[model samples]
Target: MTQSMEDFITDAFEQNYERIRLETGRAVTPNIKEAAREQVLLYYRRMRDVADGVTDTEVKLTLPEQRTPQQRKFTLEGVVDIVREGDRTTMYDVKTHLDADAAAGQLDQYVQQLNLYAHIWQGLRGEALDETAIIATRPTRELRQALRSGDDRVIDAAILKWRPCLNIPLDEHAVEDTVQRFGTVVDRIEERHFMPPAVEKLKAPIRPGARQPFGTAVCANCDVRFTCDSYRQFRLQTTPGMNPERVLQDAMNEYAASSEQGQWVDANMETLNRDRLPDAEDIDRGDV
Candidate 1:
């Protein structure tokens, strides 16, 4: 007896979902769970026939402490997957996105991170790395639309056309520079220097790599936005001009004259008017 692909996918999804729940104590809604299952199924379907040359997965690397005279000790660590084919080796860092090219502006940051990993691999571990790339698992909009439509033909067509891999260039020379910047950040943390950026800066993009204002893209998603003075100031600066007193008065008037209250009063008045009217039976018997 052979196991079908659908059955295999279902078993894999259940196992992974359970593991995630147990490890992280994270609960997802039904829609999110279904989407995750679809992603897994799509990945498997695409990679089923391709030779990945996967030698190792989830390979954790801890770089040695490069900064000296520090109050506290810290090490940079990262996880990556390695693919080896004969003498050539490739390192892959997996990322999830709706579009693979959505992070194009952040390429430099990725390069710096991957360069550090390359340094650790080549310089520290004496392992040769031929290439480094980001395997973005982006389930395309077409596939998602097809899934929503529940059309098998459309889904199959979309799945076959979907491509999610993005290759990143390896910059070995930037490794030392990236490491120095990391040391500076660690020093700031150890010194308890947690000063936030200015309000004007918060209104600007987080970095040259970002596409939108930091307030819109990053600060809006932050849980502590309401408590942050900079965020409050940014919101005030961006909000449309309005008379606070007039707005307050208008709100009060609206609450007082709400449609539901008006409806209730009208209904009561109608009942009272009906009660005061002459009875049809009395009029008919001439007994009014």
Candidate 2:
């Protein structure tokens, strides 16, 4: 019987559940939904075939049974493509139907996810992965245009960093540190502290003859859409009722306050300007 995507995800979850339980002393919530997993796996399978010049029947990932008191294990989330040639292995993320440029822009997160898996895999197998990549299954014409304009340097750097983990010894301390870091990231996300720049960035108005609409399937299905006041207000304000200027101003104010508390900048004029926006009178009255 062909294993369903949920079955694959459940297997992956089970593989890491023990470690997670030990680390957090609680059940680990499954984050990757089956739909997302299936989509990712489909892409990974396709890309792997293309890169490896082999069919799915020929490729395999050597996942071992749970062993060692402090062994690391890799849980495939949404791997879409894999290319293996001898000792060299390159994995590709299949972002089917998403804007390639947008996917490429946020490729850092994907690279990090791949590296985390690679780290766990290396711990288990005592070998390093060669490279990681993101391949858009159905890239937009504009994204293809941008790709032709320049090579992706950011992705290259992220892949390079993954190379160093190969020689790193996987001991209890290292495994603990990895788990702790992962937990911290998870905590931040749970608390919404890791929220990215506002939806305006994601929904930047498309120009004429550009992309008619600019959003991915993930964005469409995002649970936060209703909760995200900005996105909700943006949609409601299709006419003149919704004020983009006010939305921007409020976001800027919130950002400034957070920045000040975070101490993300040195005491400087630029920081001061950000902290203090010009009042209407200060601007029109030439109070500068």
* Best candidate, lDDT: 1
Q: In model 1, state the lDDT of residue 127.
A: 94
What's model 1's overall lDDT? 0.69
Across residues 87-187, which tens digit of lDDT does each residue of candidate 1 receive? Answer: 98988787655344444535677789888888888888899999887765657556668878888898888778876665677887898788777887888
Residue-by-residue lDDT tens digits, candidate 2, 1-288: 225744665577556654554554443112223334434443333333453353232223343342322344333333334456777765544455554544554444555555655555556656556765555544345433443556666333333322111121223344444444555655565556745446565455333334433333244445555456655454444435557676545544543465553343443333355446689989899976
Using TM-score as the measure, which candidate wins? Answer: 1
Over 4 Å off, model 2: 1-81, 141-182, 188-218, 236-288
Candidate 2, residue 61: Cα displacement in angstroms equals: 8.7
For every model shown, what is its TM-score relative to the native structure?
0.65, 0.39
lDDT of 1 at 14: 86
Task: Please give the RMSD to the true structure for each candidate, in Å.
Answer: 15.8, 21.4
